[model samples]
Target: MIIPAIDLIKGEVVRLHQGKFNLKRKYLYEPLFYIQKCLKEGAKKIHIVDLDGAKNPNKKQINLLKEISKYQIPSIQIGGGIRSQKDIDLIFDLIPNAQIILGSSIIKDFKNVQKWFNLYNPHSIILALDIKFNKNYEKIIFINGWQNKSNMIFEDIIEKFLNIGLKYVLCTDISRDGTFLGPNINLYTEIVKKYPEIFFQASGGISTLQDILNLKNSGVKNIIIGRAFLEKKFTIKEANLCWQKE
Candidate 1:
C-alpha cells in the first residue's frame, strides 16, 4: 500500500528534506486539499505527522486532523507527539477512527506501548521507527523526528516489539527521509527478512517508481511517500497503477 504524508506545523502542510526539522517547505495546497488530491489520485491510506508536537509537546495539530477527518477518505494513519496516554486519548477524542502511530513515545516507554497493545486492537496502532544509518553502518532508530538518537538497534528493537504482540511498524530511514533521494532498500530488505511476520510500512527517500519497485522486490508490503508524491516526482495515480505491474 502507498500512504501519502501530510506533515503539519501550525496548521500548514510542510515537507522536510531528509527528516531535518529545520529544512521545511510549505506546500501551495491546504492540508485537507492536499489530502483530497492524494486520495483522488488513488491513495488508499494517508500519513499525517504533527510537527509542532514532535518538536514541542506543548503544541498540537488537531485542527489539521479535524479538517482531514471531515472527508471520508481512506484510512488515515497519524504520528508525532504521542508520548502519554493523555495524548493518545486526546487523539482518539479528536479523530477517534483514525489509526494511531507512536513515534519516540513507544521507544521511550515500551511498557506504555505494551499496555496500549493489550488494550487496543492491533490494527489501530502503528509504531513509527525513525531510523538513522550511522557512519559505522550501524542502524539505530532516531526519535523526535530524527533529532534525537535512541540506543536501540533496528533489528533488536523490531524483535522486541514483535515479541510484545505489536504487528504494525512504520520504518523511516532518517538519513533519507524527506530527501526524495531513494529508500534504504538494503536495510528494509534485512529487516523484512528477519521479521516477515511483522506488517512493515517502509517510509523515507522514495524518489521514483524504481524505488517503489525495488521496495516490493525487497519484500516490503507498504510504503510512505512524502516529498516525491507531493513534488510530482511521481503521482499517486501512477503509484497505484504501477503496483499491479510489480
Candidate 2:
C-alpha cells in the first residue's frame, strides 16, 4: 500500500526534512486539499501528522483532523501529539473508524500503554517507531517528534510488545526521512524476515517506483511515501497502478 502523507504544521500543509522542524517547506493550501487530492487520485490510506500537537500534547489538532475525517474516503491514520484515551476519544468523536498511531507513549510507559490501549481493534492502533541509527550502530527509538533519543533498542521493544498484542507498526529511518533518496531496504528486510507475523509498514526516503518494487520484493507489504508524492516524483494514479500489478 502506498500511504500518502499530509503533515500539518501550524494548521497548514508542510513537510520537514529529516524530522527537523527548523528545516521544512510549507505548502500553500488547507490540509483538506491534499487529503482530497490523495483520495481523488487513488489512495487507499493517508497518513497525517500534527507537528504542533506532537510538540505540545495539550494542543490537539482537533479541527484539522475533524475536517479530514469528514471526507470518509479511505483509511485515515493520525499520529503526533496523541498520548491518552481522552485524545483518542476526541479523535473518534470526529471519525469513529479512524486509526491512531502511538509514539512516545510506547517509551514513556510501555506497560501502561500496552495494557491501557486495549480499547480498540488491534489493527486500528499502530506503534510509530521513529528511530535513528546511533553512532554505536544500534537502532535507538526517538520520541517527542524525534527530539529525544532513548537507550532502548528497536528490536527489543518490538519483541517485548509483540506478546502483548502489538499487531501493527510503522518504522521510519529518521536520517533518511523526507530526503527522497530511498528507504533503508536492508533494515526493513531484516525486520520483515524476523517477525513475519507483525504487519510492518516501511516509511521514509521513498523516491521512485523501483524503491517501491525493491521493498515489496523484500517482503514489505506496505510502503509510506511522503516527499516523493508531494514533490510529484510520481502520481497517486501511477502508484495505485503499481499496487494493482502486485
Top candidate (TM-score): 2
* lDDT (Cα atoms) of all candidates against the true structure: 0.82, 0.84
- Model 2, residue 220: C-alpha shift (Å): 1.5
Model 1 stretches astray by more than 4 angstroms: none
- The per-residue C-alpha lDDT of model 1 at residue 169 equals 83
For model 1, residues 12-34, the per-residue Cα lDDT tens digits are 88988777767888888788788
Off by over 4 Å in 2: none
In the range 1-246, model 2's lDDT, one tens digit per residue, is: 888988887788888889999999988778888878898998988888898888778876777777777687668888988888788778777877778888988888776677655666677788999889878878899988888888789998888888767888899999899898788999899988999998889988989988888888778778888888888999988987886676
